[model samples]
Target: MRAMAYETYGGTEVLRETRLPLPKVAPGEVLVKVRCAGVNPVDWKIMAGGLDSLMDVVHPVVPSWDVSGTVERLGIDVPEFAVGDEVMAYARKDYVHGGTCAEYVSVPVRALAAKPASLNWAQAAGLPLAGLTAYQLLTRLGTTADDTVLVHGAAGGVGSLGVQLARAQGARVIGTASPRNHDRLRGFGCEPVTYGDGLTERVRALAPDGVTVVADFVGGVLDTTLAVLAEGGRHASIADHTVLGAGGQWMWVRPDSEDLSTLGRLADQGRLTVDVAAMFPLSELAAAFTLSQEGHASGKIVIEV
Candidate 1:
């Protein structure tokens, strides 16, 4: 199998496409023929050795987490799926051998879910990490139908899905994005606010009662968000943890098959959208990593294996 891997952590330059034996499936795991893989910021963070502190958990990492593919074989103790079952999964957390970037990967059955029938492999590949992050954060914050939820970076992968999920739950959503994405946000039923000076004031003018939940995907301007939150309201972040010591949950999404199943239903029902801003072949993963690290992706970037 051909895979993009790095023996040492440093930068994208450390990544190389190499041929290696396909991974073996362990008990309760399924071997998948990967069709598409989703790229996230954490992939680059680990690549740059920024996550070395967690090295005990994550090691020579293959660098991708989300995969959309077909189950080619099932390991012992796995009963729910058989060979040729089309599925999507957020592979287990192992910085070193979480091998979604290759043509085949072995993922635990608990981390795998049936892919949405309505979506293509690329679209399904984009959902696991981003969609689950948005889903878990909103649910953990105790969001209710009457609440107004504000999502920072609403045009990016997780933010875009978060905006739609908030609306689907009947909450009023105010999403921060550039002027160009205002229409896109509006289409998702979000009140688009430009991110910059007086952003809190602008949001306040739109929702005078103040936001009931602030889910920050961008670490910057969290103080502004806190100022605009209604009393007793919750604030959660998946990106920044600098102010977590003050209060509120700083979340890191873990692999959850249940969450992926829920997201799949939403996508199948046309209630959630998986936005893929660009797609690169597995061979061009280096360029994809460069773009993802630059922090300007409008949506998820995927690699077709």
Candidate 2:
């Protein structure tokens, strides 16, 4: 199978297209013929050894966790899906290896969900990791209709979904982004606020009583988050671990079939949508990684296999 991989931790310069044997399917796993792979900031982060302490890296690592594909084969005891079923997964394993950037990837059955019919291959591929991160954060914070939710980095992949999911819960949503993305947030019924320089004042103008919940997708915003949060409010961050020291949850997204399925249903019901910022062919994985590292994309980046 043709794939792009890096044998050592480095930047896009280390990524090269190479031929690799098809991944072996373990019990309770399924081999998926990759249709599209979603590229997240974490993909590039992992490529550069950003997660060296948290995950073990295997040589020649293929570096994406989000996949939308069809089942080419199933392993023993996997009764949940049939061969040929279109699926999407947050395919992270205990170790860092055998990712979705290849022609084929072996995903554990526990991480698989049927792809949403309303989405194209690119959108489907984009949904799993970012969607699930937003969903889990909102769900864990117990956002309710009466709550006013503030989302940091609202124009980026995970933050975009976080705003939508919070809005879906009937919460009044406030999101932080650049002026260019303010109009985009408004389309999702979110009140837009500039993220830097007097961010607290801007958010306060919208919710004088302070926000009832804060979801931080961008790091280095804890001071602003704490300043605008209402008394007794809940908060969490996927980027900043120091939130843990301030009585906030520091979260990591997990692969759950049920959660991914709920995201699919939301997409089908028109309550959620994926915006794809760019798409690259399999051999151009390095270009995709470079784009993600640039940190300017307003939506998910995808690799079409």
Candidate 3:
């Protein structure tokens, strides 16, 4: 099998395209012949040893967690899928090796879900991590239909999905982004506000009394979030852990088939969509990593296998 892997944690320069043995299908896991893989900030973070404190490292690590592909074979006791079924997963394992940035990946049944039929391979590959982050944050905050929600950094991958999901639930959404992306945010059913000096004041102008929920996708927006949040409203952040000490939830997306499946259903129903900012072939994997690390891409970056 061909894979992009790193022998040591450093930078994208450490990544190489080389032949590796096929990943064995362990119990309760399925082997997926990957059609495409999503490139996320966490991929490069793991590559550079940013997460070494939290996760154990195995040499020759493959770095990606989101995959969309066909099931080629099933492991022992894996009864939820068949050989030809198309599926996707946030396939992070208990350790940091054997990831989705390869021709094949073994995903546990607890993380797998049927891919949304409405999405093509690249789009489906892009949905798992970002979509699940948006979904879980909203669910954790107890968002309701009557709520007025504020989304920080709303034009980026996860924040864009948060804007759509909040609107789908019948909430009025106000999203903060740059002037160029304000129109894009409006298309996602949000009232766009520019993020800058008077971010709190801008949000307040839209929701006079204050917003009912503040979902911060970009870190360092806690001050604005607190300023605009309603007296009894809830708030959470996936990017900032200090939210835990501030009476807000510090969220991390989990490998739950149920949550992933709900996102798939929403995609199938035309309530959710994924935007692909760019695609790369396996050999150009380094370029993809650099783009994701730059933090300026408007949508998900994908690798076509």
Candidate 4:
């Protein structure tokens, strides 16, 4: 199989297209023929050793956790899916080794979910990680119709989904983004507020009393989150761990087939959607990584296999 991998942690320059033997499928897992892989900031960050202390690295690491593909074969004891079933997963394992940026990947049954039929390959590929992040954060915060929610970095991959999910739950959403993306957020049924200078005031103008929930995807905005959060309101941050010290949850998305399936149901029901910013061939994964690192993309970047 041809894969984009790196033998050492460094930069996108280290990624090389090379041939590798087929990944061995463990019990309760399935070997998926990759159709597309989603590019997240964590992919490049892992390449740059951002998770060195938290995860053990194996040489020749394949670097993507988001996958949308078809099950080619099932491992022992797997009874949930059949061959040729279209599926997707946030395929993050306990260690950094095999990943989705390849022709094939082995994903556990616990992480696998039927892909949303309404989404194209690119959109399906992009949904797992970012969608799960948004879903888990909103669900954990117990978001409801009466709440006014604030989303930081609302135009980016995860934030964009968070905006939609919050809106789907009937919450009034105020999303932070640049002027260019404000209209995009509005289309998702969110009120857009420009971030940066006076972000708190802008959010406050919309919520008046204060936002009932805050979901921060782009971090570095704890001050604004605190300023606009209503008393006794809830908040969580995926990017900033310091939120733990601020009476807010610092969350990391997990791979749960049930949660992923919920997202798939929402997509199929037309209550959720994924925006793909760009697509690159599998061999051009380095370019995709660079784009994710640059951090300007308003939607998910994907590698089409």
Backbone clashes in each candidate structure, one number apiece?
3, 0, 0, 0
Angstrom error of the Cα, residue 232, model 2: value is 0.5
Cα displacement (angstroms), candidate 2, residue 194, comes to: 1.0
Report clash pairs, candidate 1. 58-95, 59-96, 61-96
Report the C-alpha lDDT of model 1 over 230-287, residue by residue, as the tens digit: 9888999987786587577899888898989999999999999898999999999999
For residue 138, model 3's alpha carbon misses the true position, in angstroms, by 0.4
Instruction: List ranges where model 1 is wrong by over 4 Å.
Output: 57-59
Q: In model 1, what lDDT does residue 4 have?
A: 88
Clashing pairs in 4: none
Model 3: which residue pairs collide? Answer: none
Which prediction has more favorable lDDT, 2 or 3? 2
**TM-score, prediction 4:** 0.99
TM-score of each: 0.97, 0.99, 0.99, 0.99
Model 2 spans > 4 angstroms off: none
Query: lDDT of model 1 at residue 62?
Result: 77
TM-score of 2: 0.99
CA lDDT of every candidate: 0.89, 0.95, 0.93, 0.95
Q: How many clashing residue pairs, candidate 2?
A: 0
- lDDT by residue (tens digit), candidate 4, 1-305: 99999999899889999999999999999999999999999999999999999999898899999999999999999999999999999999999999999999999999999999999989999999999999999999999999999999999999999999999999999999999998899899999988889988888888889999999999899999999999999999999999999999999999999999999999999999999999999999988888888899999999999
